[model samples]
Target: MNKKTVKDFFDNLAKDWDSFEQPDSAVIEKILDYADIQIGCSVLDIACGTGILFPYYLKRNPLSITAVDLSEKMCAQAEKKCTDKRIKIICADILDTHTVTDKAERCLVFNAFPHLGNAKDAVQALCRHLVPGGILTVAHSESRESINNRHKEKAFSVSEPLPSASDLADIFSEYLEIIHVFEDESVYIVSGRM
Candidate 1:
């Protein structure tokens, strides 16, 4: 999907996005556990809609967080919820060059991977900001089937079907060492080290 379409779709839904998509706490903990986010680590959150994962990332006590997204309204919503000096909300596309000036110890693409246009290209762009030995993770609180079915039912032009966890692992492997690839009825996650 094109950038404008994705941006507009998210922007239109920003106000009620949280109510529509509630994340499971246990699944979130599982994702964060697999993410291996250490205290004082720098983090990059891609497609950070309404900062859904911000509070969770904050709970890990990261030194800094750079949240990037394409929708202006979504970023605005995120900004309203974020008061921590450690967090910097940027309204921009992650696929763009120089979007994030600093490198991060952990880069998370949570609950938003399918909206990215090309899986390989998105992973390539995200890895550029990861410090050496840093990890990059793509995760979803919901199962692949559930997410895909929701998108299909919504008939959204901007949303693409999520790939299998193993396929995503292959994509991550092209740039970084594969760390984990797991999927089940509850969640989907793929992590790698740069």
Candidate 2:
């Protein structure tokens, strides 16, 4: 799908995006565990729709959080939800090298990877901003089949199907040391250390 089309699609739904999905706290805990977010470290929240995970990230007391999204309305929604001084919301594509100038200790792409134009290239770009030994996690609170089926039903031609856990692990392995891979009825996660 065209990048502009995807951005517009999400912009239309940004105001109500938080209501569309309720992420399970337990699963978020697991994902964060794999992320290994350290105290006082920098974080990059990619595709941070409505800042749904901002509260969770705040719990770790990170030094800074740079949240990026392609949709301006989505970024505005995130800004409304997260008023913390440590969080900086940017209305720009994280895949663009110039958009994020600083490296981060932890990077997360949560519940939004399939919409990327090129998943492999996106991962590579995210890895470039990851500090040595930092972790990057791509996760979905729902199962792969559930996410894919919903996209298929919606007929959003922009949405790409999520790969199997093992397949994603292999993809992440190209840029990071594979740390975790888990996919079950409830959730999908693939995390690696940079």
Candidate 3:
């Protein structure tokens, strides 16, 4: 699917997106644990649809957060959910390094990696946003198989099947140091550091 298809599909689902799709809170906690983020963390939340991770990130006492999405409606919803002075929302394709500056100590792509048009380029771009030792994570609350099945739904015209954890780790290794790769019935995560 093209960029327009992705935007339109997510836009149509933006308004009650949470009720239709909710990530488990445990997974959010797991991501935080893996990253070992502390106060003064600067974050870049890629594909931050509806700001689902906003509250969690806020609780970390981050210095700042840059939330980005391709769907305008999704960004609008996220804007409504997060009113923190540190959080900034932008609606733009992740592939296009839009007007936002890229300087974050932690870049997290929660449940939004597969939709990227090119995994390799996406990893490379995400790496550019990080500080020298910053972490980048592509994580999902559900198993890879479960997520693939969900993307098979009628609304998904621009989604790609998720690569196995090892494949993802290799992709990330091209630009960053592979830290951890975990995939099981409960969650999938590929984390690396620049």
Candidate 4:
């Protein structure tokens, strides 16, 4: 799908996005656990609609967080969800590198991978913001196979298939080291260190 179509789809869903697509807390916990975020580290949550992962990140008591999303209404909702003064939310496209800053301790892409037009570009943008030795995680509330099947069923244009754990490792080979790949009952987590 083109950027406009993707933007409209999400914009239309912004109001009920969270309730309509509630993530499994178990899956969320597992992904965050694998992240192993440390205190005082700056983290970025990409495509962070409604900031579902914000609460989990807050538990780690990070020094700060930067959340970005393409939909303005979604960002508004996330702003309400995230009350911490340290959190800064940006309403912008993930593919726009100009909107992202550099060298975060961790960067997270959760439940929003397939929606991206260029997964490689998105990954590269995140990498640009990750400190040397920083971590990056990509997770979903369902298994890769399940997520793929659901997208097919919905007739959503998946420009690129979500990468497998091994695929991700290869993609980030130059900039990161694969740390772990976890596939639980309802989620898949791919963690890497920069």
Candidate 5:
């Protein structure tokens, strides 16, 4: 989807985004567990709609966090939810590498990868920002097959099919080391070290 479409989609849902349907708590917990965020590392939360994962990450006391989204309203809501001084919210597309380059110790693309349209570009962008040995975790609220089947049933055209855990590992293998890949309930966590 284009920026306007993404913006409009999230803007209209900003207020109720958090309460919208989501992965189970167990799945969320599993994803967070795989994050392995340290005490003082910089983090970039891409497409962090409504800041659902901010509080969880904040509890780990990160040195700093930059939460980015294509929707201004969603970013505003996240800013409000993330009261920590260490947090900075940006209303911008995550695919814009120049907008957020070499700034994070870790990057998270949670429940937002499929919507990216260009998953490879998104993965490369995250790889570029991450420090050497840094971590990049990409996850979805559902399995690849489940997501793909949903898209097919709905007759929606994705920019590219959702990649399986092995698919992601192979794509980023040149730049990152696979750390973990598993599904918890419907959520699938793909962790790698850059």
Candidate 6:
């Protein structure tokens, strides 16, 4: 999809994002376990739709979090939900060379990876921002079939398909040390260290 198309679609939905989904505690646990998050770690929450991950991250007490999305309304809504001093919200395309760099120890692409114009190049760029041994994760609270079907159900801006497990394994292994891959009826998580 065109970058602006994706931005506008989400910006329009930002106000009602909570009506779309809430972070599932079980899925959040799986994500944290896969990433091996610890207290005081720096986190980059990419495409952090309406800051759904904010409360969970705060519970882990991260040192800092840079929540980013291409939608202005999305970021504004996130800023409103997240009152913590550690989180910084940015509305920018992650593919931009200089959008955010060398800042986070853990980079999370939650429920928003497939929309990328180019997933491989985008993954490489996100990996560039991590500290050595940092983690990069792409996750969803729903299964592969469910996510894809849901996107298809609506005339949404997400035009690209979420990669298969093997495809994602290749992408993750290409940019960072492959850690774990999980795909079940309700969730999917692919993570690695940078």
lDDT of each: 0.90, 0.87, 0.86, 0.79, 0.78, 0.83
Query: Candidate 3 clashing pairs?
Result: none
Candidate 3 Cα lDDT to native: 0.86
Query: Whole-model lDDT, candidate 4?
Result: 0.79
Q: Write the per-residue lDDT of candidate 6 for residues 85-190, one digit (tens) a residue.
A: 9888888887789685447888888888877757788788888778998999888878888777877877356657787766898988977888888888887888
How displaced is residue 91 in candidate 6, in Å?
1.2
Candidate 5: list runs displaced more than 4 Å. 151-160
- Full candidate order by lDDT, most accurate first: 1, 2, 3, 6, 4, 5
Q: How well does each candidate superpose onto the true structure, as a TM-score?
A: 0.96, 0.95, 0.95, 0.91, 0.88, 0.94
lDDT of 2 by residue, 25-126 (tens): 999988887778768989999899889899999998999999989999999888887889999988888887788557898998998998886778878988
Q: For model 4, how does the per-residue alpha-carbon lDDT over 1-194 read when each residue is reduced to its tens digit?
A: 57777767677788887788876776677788788776889988888988888888888899999998887878988989878998999888767756746468888888888887666676777787788889989888888888777777873763457778677767766567888776755787877898
Which window of 10 residues has the lowest lDDT sum in candidate 5?
A: 151-160
lDDT of 1: 0.90
- lDDT of the structure predicted as candidate 5: 0.78
Residue 170, candidate 5: how far off, in angstroms? 0.9
Error of 1 at 112 (Å): 0.4
Model 6 poorest ten-residue lDDT run: 155-164
Best prediction by TM-score:
1
Compare the candidates by lDDT and give the number of the best one.
1
Clashes of each: 0, 0, 0, 1, 0, 0
In model 2, the number of clashes is 0
Q: Which lDDT value does model 6 have at 159?
A: 52
